[model samples]
Target: MKILFMLRDPFYEAYPTFIEAARELGEVETLYPDRGIEKAEIIKEIANTDILVVAKVKIDKEVIDAGARLKYIIKYGAGYDNIDIDYAYEKGIAVTNSPGQNAESVADNVFGLMLATSRNITKKDHEMKSNHWELSVGHEIYMKKIGIIGFGAIGKAVAKRAMGFSMEAIAYGHYLDPLAAKELNVRFVTLEELLTTSDYIIISTSLTEKNKGLINQNTIRLMKRSAYIINVSRGGLINEVDLMEALNQKQIKGAGLDVFSAEPPQNALPLLDNVVATPHIGGATYEALVRMADVTMTNIKRYLAGEELLYRVYPQEVRK
Candidate 1:
């Protein structure tokens, strides 16, 4: 059996996990494309693949068609939106993800962004380095309202951390569980209510067609002018141009974004006094990567052994 490993980059730190998994399964062929490979190239490489592991690489219908022997696909992280689910299903391929593998790290990053934005930590740090800092007013998180979009693992983790700061937490999601909300001491609210009332808004939702461009100008207009928006979620969740306009016109107080609609935007967008940008490091922590790799390898091993994968997506769908 041959397994094609398509990674966005070479994760040398996690190579041992892959090597071990390969020894237990079959041959492991690896490819690291600095730039995303085109569909034709993907099809060419997937012709003999038995199992495919992908990270941030598009696996559309054309590529799936070329995988005559492909049985399964495992994503390195929680999100699998990059893959064409309908096409994978049609090809009878099982897809799996390592969800909750980096929830703690991502949640921590979300909180860090919230604190930095609310307290103006980044701004003051820049000022001090420029020799312009005297004393700057910073906001306290205590007794503040925090709204979390997407009440998934990471969202729950963020809410749990907010408890330490004595902040009230509210959340919105399609899969809102009343029992879970009660247990977490989080109020369930509509997206609009959360946007309007939250002093700090943290987005942890996975991207989908419905959620793309979720944080548009209309949504931004509903938020408190002094409120700060934090996105540790997928970049597609926010409309870049609309967000830029909001920040430029002070529609919302500020934004701390880890992901952008187009990663590494070609033209520099204005970073206002209140804005902070990060290069999508929500799950890039060393500890998180190791944990994720372990989980991913375990899932792959199970699939190879003809056992049900722990995090399988679209497992029951009948395929062509």
Candidate 2:
């Protein structure tokens, strides 16, 4: 069997176990596409691949068809929206992700974004660089109404951190864990209530068809003018154009985005002000990368040995 790695940067080192196991599985090839390549490029390079290891790359039907021998696909992180899971399933290809690998790092990064947005950290730093001594008064996150949209491991971590800051936390999800929510003191509320009542909205939901544009203009219109929204989840959860319009029209106080609809947009949008845009670095910490790689390799080895995987992504349990 052969394994192909379609990765973003060439700097990631494969886990030691994966390197050792690859010797028994023939050669391991890697494909690096241009940042702006079309679907044809992806399809072309996936030819003859068996197992495809991907990271933030789109694996549409055409690309799937190109990999005639593909038996499995492993995403580096938790989100597998980049892959066409339906097609992969129909073709008998198992799709997996390294969940819990980036949970702690993403939880910490979420708060970092929240604090930076609320305290105007980026803006103050820029002003001070220009020799301005005047202090810009920013809102304090303490005692603020924080609405978390999802209640997964990452969401629980974020809620706990918010409690430490004395923020009142609430959440909305398809299936609520009452015991977990009660333990964390997160109020279970309707999505509408979460939208209108929160002073700071932190989106921690996974991406699915139902949640693709959950944060559209209608939802944005419901938020308080003093509210700020943070998204460490998948980019499609919020409509980018609507978010930009809201920020530009002053409909919302501010936003902290770690993901975007089209990553590395053609040009900077006007929402740059009163908004902190990160290049999807929620799980980019060195510690997270190492841990995620180890988890990914473990899953691969288990699958090869015909054993059960620890961090598997079951098709039925997928967010979509």
User: Which candidate leads the pack in lDDT?
Assistant: 1
Which pairs of residues clash in candidate 1, taking residues 3 or more apart in a chain or in different chains?
none
Please give the lDDT score at residue 134 for candidate 1. Answer: 75
Worst 10 residues of 1 by lDDT: 311-320
Off-target runs (Cα >4 Å) in candidate 2 are 10-26, 33-41, 314-320
Model 1 shows how many backbone clashes?
0
Residue 266 in model 1: shift from native, Å?
3.8
Candidate 1's TM-score: 0.91
